[model samples]
Target: MAILATEGLTKRFPRVTALDELTVMAGTGVTGLVGANGAGKSTLIKILLGLLPPTSGRARVLDLDAATHGLEIRRLVGYMPEHDCLPPDVSATEFVVHMAQMSGLPRTAARERAADTLRHVGLHEERYRPIGGYSTGMRQRVKLAQALVHDPRLVFLDEPTNGLDPQGRDEMLALIRRIGTEFGISVLVTSHLLGELERVCDHVIVIDAGRLLRSSAIGDFTQASQAIAVEVEDGLEPLVERLGGLGEAVAVQGRLLTVQVPADADPGRTYDAVRDAVCDLGLNLVRLEQRRGHIEDVFKEPVA
Candidate 1:
């Protein structure tokens, strides 16, 4: 089922249409909303959350109309805003409890849920420390804990990896993946970094300057293209030689050796050929797979 849908969803600002007549259906799991700074990703999220009224068109969340069922939708959805909004002096526990109460939890339940959620988001003893002393990663966890405090059906994570180092980004991405796989909560995460989302999202929605560009499942989006990713234990030079000898087009980009799978190529025989070639060269086959296109590659292609 399409958990979220929008049709002709337009949002106008004073000088610009932040979201043009956009239409998209986001299914379950993690769907990435990706674009550059002014791509209307934020605008669309605002409209979906009922934080901003659309200039035109309609949208629905979890089958409820965005306009008519805003409160109900809000109750079932969680949001982590991109910018920092935490109180500097408040402890994460105190802050999260307040958020849970705001979500309509009873005071006792809110406190208990807040503690559990904080622990779940990896804030332990330090959760009692004031927010001002928390590192960027800690702050992000605090924000995420609050979002999950109410046990929402879905979460909209706006740049969850922002301000983190490469290590932090990887950990955050893994956590986002676990949110879907372990908890089964739907996630609609937005990020300007296409590559990072490519690693996490089950589906991707690409926008450009307030216009819908593309929306596709991750499987469909990363489908094997012209480049065939080749892997071997060793003797790369020989495999490269023999493939080229057979008049195949091949190139080495970083760790991947991309070869052209012939137009009339037999899919099953292709791997066998690679396997045989590796045996002939006395090399173990490590990885010989298809080269999947990344989300960033979609932009490189001439916009259709």
Candidate 2:
């Protein structure tokens, strides 16, 4: 089932159109919403959460009309905003428990759930320290912990790794993946870094200039190309010429030669041809592998 869906959704702010007839759907898994800084990713999330109304079109979250059932939808959907919104003076446990109680949990249950959620998010003794004293990674975890403390069915995580270092980013990505797979909670995560999402998302939705560019499974986004990349230690020009002479469509990409593998050509024959050409040229084969596409490729095109 689709966790969220939008059709012809657009949002305008006086001089700028943040979203322009945007349409997309997210299912039950970790879905990455990718785009540049001004691509309207945040606007879309706000509309879906009923925090912002679309200028036109329709949207639904968890089968609830975003316009009408926003209260109930917010109750079921957790959101970790991109920016820092934590209270500096409050401890993680205190903040999350307050959030849980605000979400309508009883005081006792809120406290208990907050403790569990904080621990799950990798906040231990530090959870009791003032958020102002916590590192960027710890603050992100506290934000995440509050979002999940309510036992939400789905979460909209905006730039969860925004200020995180490389190690913190990896750890957070692992947590996001675990939330989707182990906890069985659907997640819609946003990031400007296309490659980062490729590592953890089951599906990816690419947007550009406030419009949908492409949406597909991660595997489909990074499918094997018909071309194989070959890198030679030396004499690249000679190898390129030899491969071209053998009827392979070869294109030079930096130090690598990209050879388009013909559909009807035998794999073994192609390998033999490449091997013999390299051997005949006496050049060292540094690497050879089928090149794969990436989600970033979609953004390279003009907006449609």
Candidate 3:
């Protein structure tokens, strides 16, 4: 079942159209919302969260109408905005507990849940420190902690890795994966970096200029291409000539030769032909593997 769905959703600002007839369905698990800046990713999240009303069309969250059940939807969904929204004077524990209470938790229960959530997010003794004293990674964790503290069924994480170093980004990504896989909470994570999502998302939805570009499983997005790359220890020129003579479209790049495997031809035959060509030229095969497609490939196509 889909946790979120949109039909012909459109949102317009005073002079710009943020979302233009966007339609998409997101299932349970980690679904990535990928697009460049001004691609309508944040606008879509706002609409789905019932914070912004669309100019046209309809949207639903957890099978509830976003237009009519905005308050109810907010209760079940947690949001971590892109920009820093934390209060610098308050400690992480205090802020999280306050958020839980605002979400309708009693004082005692909110404190208990906040403590457990802070621990789960890897915030130990530092969680009691004021937000102004925390590092970038620790602040990100505090943001994540509040989102999960309310025991929300779903979370919308917008640019969770913004302004972090390499190590911090890796840790945040791992925590996001754990939230979806280990905790079983459906996640809609938005990021401008396309390659990063490939490692964490089960499915991806690409949007360009507020329009749906492509939506599919992550595996389908990065399926194997129709070319195989071959590398040899020596006799590069001879192997290229031999492979070209065998009716293969070959392109040389430094020490590697990329051969196009014909669609109508057997793939195994291509592998065998490569092996035979190397053997005939007395060259040692170093590596021969199909060049797999990447999530970035989708951006190369014209927007639909």
Candidate whose TM-score is highest? 1
**Per-residue lDDT tens digits of candidate 3, residues 1-304?**
8999999999999999999998899999999999998899898989888889999999999999998899999999989888888999999999999999999999999999999999988999998889999988899999999899998989999999899997798789889999999999999999887677767899989988999888988876633346789999988999888888888889999999998877566678888989899887788889987664444667886654
In the predicted model 1, the residue pairs found to clash are: none
A best-first ranking of the candidates according to their lDDT comes to: 3, 2, 1
Better of 1 and 3 by lDDT: 3
Error of 1 at 237 (Å): 11
How many residue pairs clash in model 2? 0
Candidate 2 regions with alpha-carbon error over 4 angstroms: 223-296, 301-304
Clashes of 3: 0
| Model 2, residue 96: C-alpha shift (Å) | 0.4
lDDT of 2: 0.88
| lDDT tens digits by residue: candidate 2, 51-78 | 8988998999999989788999999999
**Clashing residue pairs in candidate 3 (N, C-alpha, C atoms within 3 angstroms):** none
Off by over 4 Å in 1: 223-295
lDDT of 2 at 77: 92
